[model samples]
Target chain A: MEVAHADDVELAHRIAAGDEAAAEEVVRSLGREMFGFARRMLSDSGAAEDAMQETLLAILKGASKFDGRVPLRAWGFGILRHKITDTLRKRGREAVIGDVDPERDAFNAKGAWKHMNFAPWREDEETLQVVRDCMETLPLRQREALELFAVEGKDGVEAAALLGVTPVNLRQILHRGRSAVRKCADAKLGSDED
Target chain B: MDDRIRARCDCFYQVLSDYIDGELSEEEAGLVREHLLLCPPCLVYLEQFRIVHQACGKVESDDLPADFDVVMQGVMTAWRKDRCGDPEPGS
Candidate 1:
């Protein structure tokens, strides 16, 4: 989530200069996140591995074009995004599904939340565990959307860019993820209380 | 709740998320803020939603391969060989 812009620029310049150690350091720093990103985006672990390799190879091959203006992570993420997109395309549509009805709420037609009480609660270990569980219940695309936006702390535009969706589409997907998970958590917790 | 009052809170519930993310304009944000001053339930919902998001941010990362160096070396070696071939091809 945090990018050291100045350090990134320096790293990019060094990599562009064909500094092997600098390239290694770049891999050390950004490789894990890029791997995780690809893993989350691709359904196949093998495909994820291929995407990660392609991402690194592309970075090194294209390092000369690194002008240091963009943060190194941004450039790296862009490459990874492209690699993932190509993998998805070559493999033919890798399961982009979504489902959510915002109207399925406890709110009455009068616009009042009837029968649902969203009481303010502090964050506890139990709540965190439940949230984690709820995340597993989301559809693939919705879950990815939420992870990038909510978990990775990327803004709508950045998350959309990573997911290859429009910003408006990202918002809708995020909203669906949030509402679906929130409602599920409520139901789960409510049943537990019962 | 009265119809107008209920409708306003409904709007707040829907857009409170945009408010949380600072997506709402100054005017829309102001209206939501003003509404929150009176609606306790929405304040609760907002807090709950925020906590859910925060907990998600804290979700433990999946286990990555212990040695990324191996993978890096493989790609770097291939990359060098590929780059060694053929001139820059006049971009």
Candidate 2:
């Protein structure tokens, strides 16, 4: 069953008060989503696993300090984001924003016609598989915004909240992410005009 | 709106993901909506955006492995036990 909206915050409060069951529930509720975010951010399964552990640890340790200004999930995601940044910094690598204009033009030129052609092939399972494969080609922030906004049902504001960016910035990332994925999907779907 | 604004209506098509998702403010949404009503290219872009949104919506969050939950449960359990010094598992 899906977790109720208030239960997440309630569980965080209880876990802060040393309730083991609540802590377990919090982990179970947010684990997969958090894992996916970490994996996408780190791009290394082992590092992602470590990041997940660190995120949970931070939640456990920092739960008492939560200001309750945002949803528990968002707050948890905030903690996870910090953990990711810290991990990356420790590894001597920082998040780099790719050149948006050139990348955009390249994908737009290649993808304009390709996506138009691939649109009709959507019913094919292979085409959807190709889309999924193409998703991995996007940069971390773009992929996160796309995954959260499109796949996980978070609105732009919520996604931006999770990523620590403004909603406008999140929208820009989503635009670029979709364009890149569409381009790659087009390439994978082949050039046959249909 | 001037010819420049009219010509750039297609540019807003790229941002329809934001608009349809309610990311735009009331004023901004009004501007885009007006453009879409007047521009065929923007309308086509909106349709494509909807299609992509629908296609993306079909991807299940169940893609995560079942074992992930089990592993997380174990990890949380261990963390709790460590915190509370519990001897019995899940007790």
Candidate 2: stretches off by over 4 Å: A1-13, A36-54, A82-94, A98-120, A151-154, A191-194, B1-9, B19-61, B87-91
Docking level of model 2: acceptable
Candidate 1 structure quality by residue, lDDT tens digits, B1-91: 2234334656666675577778877877777777777777777777777876675564256566666667767776776568566323332
Give per-residue CA lDDT, model 1, range A19-138, as digits (tens). Answer: 778878877776777777677567455677778888887787787676655566667777876677677667664545676545357577766677546654546888767876887667
lDDT for model 2, on a 0 to 1 scale? 0.64
Q: Give the TM-score of candidate 1.
A: 0.65
For residue A151, give model 2's deviation from the true position in Å: 5.3
For candidate 2 chain A, which ten residues in a row score worst on lDDT?
A109-118
Per-residue lDDT of model 2, residues B1-91, tens digit only: 2232333544565556667777666766777777767766456546645544554555354356546766776567566666777735666
- lDDT for A129 (candidate 2): 62
Q: What are the TM-scores, per candidate, against the unseen true structure?
A: 0.65, 0.67
